[model samples]
Target: MIIGIDLGTTNSLVAVWRDGRAEMIPNALGHHLTPSVVGLDDNGDVLVGLAARERLITHPHLTAAVFKRYMGSDRVTRLGRRDFRPEELSALVLKSLKLDAERYLGEPVEEAVITVPAYFSDAQRKATKIAGQLAGLRVERLVNEPTAAALAYGLHQSEPESRFLVFDLGGGTFDISILELFEGVMEVRASAGDNFLGGEDFTEALIDGFIDAVGRPRGLSDKAATPALYQALRKQAEQAKRALSSNQEAEMQVLHDGQTLSWQINDAAFQRLTEPLLKRLREPIERALRDARLKAIDLDQIVLAGGATRKPLVRKLVAKLFGRMPAMNINPDEVVAMGAAVMAGLKSRDESLNEVVMTDVCPYTLGVEVSEQIAPNRFQAGFFLPIIERNSVVPISREQTVNTIQDRQQALHVRVFQGESRQVKDNIFLGELTIPVPPKPAGEISVTIRFTYDVNGLLEAEMTVEDTGEKHRLVIEENPGVLTPEEIEQRLRELARLKIHPREHLPNATLLARADRLYQQTLGEERQWISSETARFQAVLETQDEERISAARQALKQLLDEVEGESWL
Candidate 1:
C-alpha cells in the first residue's frame, strides 16, 4: 500500500488511505507523533523517535535533533562513533516510520508522498527525496506542507467556491499560503515564509531570556564542555514555554555546574521575549495576501496548521492582523499527515478523493541575470530579468529577449537564478547555458530564452539564437549543495551497513529512555521517586512476560504523562 509521510522537523508521522478513509498509522509506541530525533547506542545500533529524543538530554554528544535545518548543507552530526550527513540522519527517521507503516499495514510498502515546507529550496527538496530513496521507499511526490493542510481541510466541504489562507508554523520552518477552491479545483495562489522561523525560535527566545538573566553558564557558553547540560536547559525551556501557553505563569529550573538556576515567566513575559519572532509571523501573511492580490478581509477563512499554531500568542497575532479568528477545526499536528495521505490517495487515483484537483505555484521567482546598456561603452551587470514571477501557476512557459552588448558577439551566456532579488548575486544560481550565436553588431544579435517550469519543480531552458535560428536546450538540474548521481550511489552503499534498532524493542526502549531523562531532570524526592520507578520498569522488562511488560509500560507512560503534562501538539 502507498503511504503519505510528513517528514517534519520536530516530529514525523505516516498515514495511509485505508478502506476509503485517510487513517493515521501509529508507531510501535502506539503514538502518531514520532519525535524527529536520531542517535546511536553504545552497541552501535541506531535509535530514532522518542528513544532518541530522550538521549538529547542524557547523551547530547551522541544524539541529533532538528537536523532538518541543515538539509541542503554538507554539515554532519557525529553520533556515537559515526559521522552522518543531515540527509542520512533524516533517512533513519524515515526508515523507522516506514517500518511502523509496514507493521501496521501488514505488508511491504514501496512508495510514498512526502511533504516539505513550501519555501524549501530546490536543493533542500532534492535532499529530502534522496533521503526517501536511502530509506528504501520511492519518493513519488513532494507536496507543499501548507498546501497539503489546505487540501485536507477543503476536501470535506461541499461549497462550490472559497478562498482561504494557510498559516503553517512548524518546529523549524514557517509557511503562509493562499489557495482558492472553485469548481472542484484547488489552486494555490501564493506562498511565502521564513524557513528559519518557527516554534523552535520561540523556545530559543526563552533560552536567550534565561541566559541573559542567569548570566551565561560556563558549560552552556561552551557546549563542548557539557553538551548534556546545554541540551537539558533547552529541553526545560521548551517545556516551560509550552506551560506558559496554557497557564498564565510557568516556572523552570535547570541545574548547571552544580548550581540550581530558576526562572519564572508569565504569558505576558514570554510574549514580550518572543515579540521579535511574533512580528516576523505577519510579513509572510501580508506577502501571501498581497501576492494573491487580496486583502485580509477578502479571505473566506484563515486555516492554521503545524503544532506551533497551538501557542496562544500566535493565535492572537493572527486575529489582530487578519481581523478574524483563524479556523482550528483540525488538529494542527495531525492535519498535514492527513492531507498528505489524501494527496497520496489522489496520486493513486483513489475514488473518494477524485473530485479534488489541486494546483500549486512556484514559490520563488525564476530568472536570469542580464547586462543592461544605458549608454555607449557603459554596461551594468547583476540586473535580474524575471521570466516567471514567484507565485505564478506551474507548468508554465515564459520567454524574455536579450540583445548582445558587444558587436559581433560569438556567444551569449544564459545564467539562471531563483529569487526575488534585483541583483543576481543575491539570488541562488541554478545553472547556466552558453548559446553560440552568429557574430553581429550590438543590438543586432538577439537570443530568446524560454523557461518552462513544470509542476514537479523542474526548470527547462531553451535558448534560440535569432540570427542563425540555432536552438540550445538545457534542463537545469545541477545545483550546489546537492550530491551528484555518483555520490548518491556511493552514499547509499555506505548507509546500508547502518543498523537501526529492531522494531520489537522500540516500545520498551522509548519508555526506558524517557524515564531516564526524567530521573536526570528532577532532584531530591522527585529524583528518588523517578529513579525507583525507572528501576522497577527495567526489572519488569527483564522478565520478558509480554502481558506484564505491556501493563507496566502503559502505567509508566501514564505516570510520566501526568508529570510532564500534555504536549502542546
Candidate 2:
C-alpha cells in the first residue's frame, strides 16, 4: 500500500489511502505528530520520535535534529563513534517512520510518496530521495510540501481560477509560495525562503530573557559558577515561555543547589525580547508577494504549515501584515501528511478516489560556476542555464550544455550551484563533476547536463561530453541519497547482524550520536539529561530492568506540548 509521509523538521506524520479517503496513522504514543528526534543507547541502538526528543534537554550533546537545512552541503556532524551526513541522519528518521507504518498496519508497506519544499534545489531533492532509499522505502514520488498541502486542501477545481500564497513556517525553514490554480494544474509562480529562520529563534529569545532577569544573559562568564542552577533555570525559562502565551504574566519557580529562585515575565515583555527575531519573518513574505507580482490583496487565500505557525505571535503578525485571516480547515499540524496521503492515492490511480492531477515548483535555481573577466572574480550563475523553469509541473526533465575552453583537455569540470545570487560564491555549491571529453580543440567540445525533477521533487542528473558516441557509454544509475549504494548496503548488513536491543541505561547513552560535538559545553543537569531520558525509555522495554524509556518520553511530551517553537527549533 502506498502512503504519504510528511518528513518534517520539527515533527513528522504519516497517512495512507483507505476506505475511499485519507487518514492519519498514529504512532505508538497515540498521537498523530511525532518529534523528528532519534536517540542512541550505549549499545548503539536507536530510539525515534518521543524517546529521542526526551534526551534533548539533558543529553543535548548527543542529540541532533533539524539537519534538514543542511541538505546539500559538505557539513559532517559527529555524535559518538560515527560521523553522519545530513542525509544519513535524515534516513534514520525516515526508516523509523517506515517501521511505525508497518507495525500499525500489520503488513509490510514498501512504497511511499514523500513531500518537499517547492523551492528545493536539484541537489537537495536528490539528497532526500537517497535518504529514502537508505530507509528501505521505495519513494514513488517527491511532491512539494506546499503543493501537497494544496492537494489536501483541494485547491484544484473546475470553477474560476484563483491564486494562492502558501506561507509554510516549519521547524528549521520558512517558505512563501505563490501559486495559480487553474483546472487540474496548480502552477507555482514563485517560491522563496530563509532556511535558518523558524521556531527555534523564539525559544532562544525566551532563554535569553531568563538570563537577563538574572543579570547575565550574553554568557555565564560573569556569574560565579552556576552549574545546577543554570539547568533548573533553563527548565523554568521554558515553562514561563509557554505560560506567557495564554496568560498576562508567568511565574516559574526552581530549586537548585539548595536555593529556590523564581522568575516572572509578562507576555508583552516576552514578545519585546523576541521582536527582532519576529521582525525578520516579514521580509520573506514581502519578498514572496513582490516576486509573484501581487500585493497582499491579490491573494485569494493564505495556507500555513510547519510547527512554528502555532505561535500566537506568528498568527498575529501574519494577520496584521496580510490583512486576511489564514485558512485553518485542515489541522495546521496534520495537513501536510494528509496531502501526502491524497497524492499517493492519485499517483496509484486508485479507482475509488477521483482524478487528482498535481503540479509544483523548483525549490532553488540551477546554475553553473562561471568566470567573468571583469576583475577575474569567479561567480556562480544561472544567467545562461535555466533548465526546467521554476514552478513547472513535476515528472519533468530538461537539459543544458556548457562548452570547454581549453584544447587537449579530456576532462571538463562541472560545478553546480543553487541560489539567486548574481555571484557564484554567494550560492550553494552542491558538488562538482569531472566529465571526460574526447581530444578536441578549445571551444569545440560541449557537455550536456540533464536534470529531472519528479512529482516528489526527486532529482536525477545525467551528463555527456561527447556527441560522437565515444563517452556516452557510461552507467546511468541514479542514486540520490547521501549514502551511495555501497554505504546503504553496509548499513543494512550491520543492522541485520546486530542483536538490536531497546535496553536503556543512564541519560548519556540515550542522546543521538551527532549531539556530542554540538552541545558538549552544557552544564551538569543538561549533561545528565541524556542519561536520565535514556533510562526513561529503556525501562519501558519488557526485557530491560533498571532501564526505563517511559519517563523520558512522557517528560519530552510534556515539555514539547508546552513548547512554543520546539518543533521549529
User: Who wins the TM-score comparison?
Assistant: 1
Model 1: lDDT to the true structure: 0.86
Total backbone clashes of candidate 2, pairs 3 or more residues apart or in separate chains: 36
Q: Give the Cα-based TM-score of candidate 2 against the true structure.
A: 0.78
State the lDDT of candidate 2 residue by residue for 343-391, as single tens digits: 8898788886565555566656665665443344343333434555554
lDDT (Cα, tens digit) per residue for candidate 1, span 1-569: 78999999999999997778789999987899999999876677889988888878888888999999999778888876678888888999999999999999999999999999998877788888889998999996889999989977854364688888899999999999999888778899999998899888988888778777663644345433468877877787888878877899987788776788888889998988999998898888888888999998888888999999999999999999888999999999989998989889998998877777889998899999998877879998898999999998987999999999988888888899989998999998888888888887888988999999776566799999887788899876566766777888888998898887888998888878888888887778877887787788889989999999999988888878876764333
Q: What is the TM-score of each candidate against the true structure?
A: 0.94, 0.78
CA RMSD of all predictions: 2.4, 6.5
Q: Deviation in angstroms for 396 in model 1?
A: 1.3
Error of 1 at 184 (Å): 2.0
Lowest lDDT sum, 10 consecutive residues, model 2, at 472-481
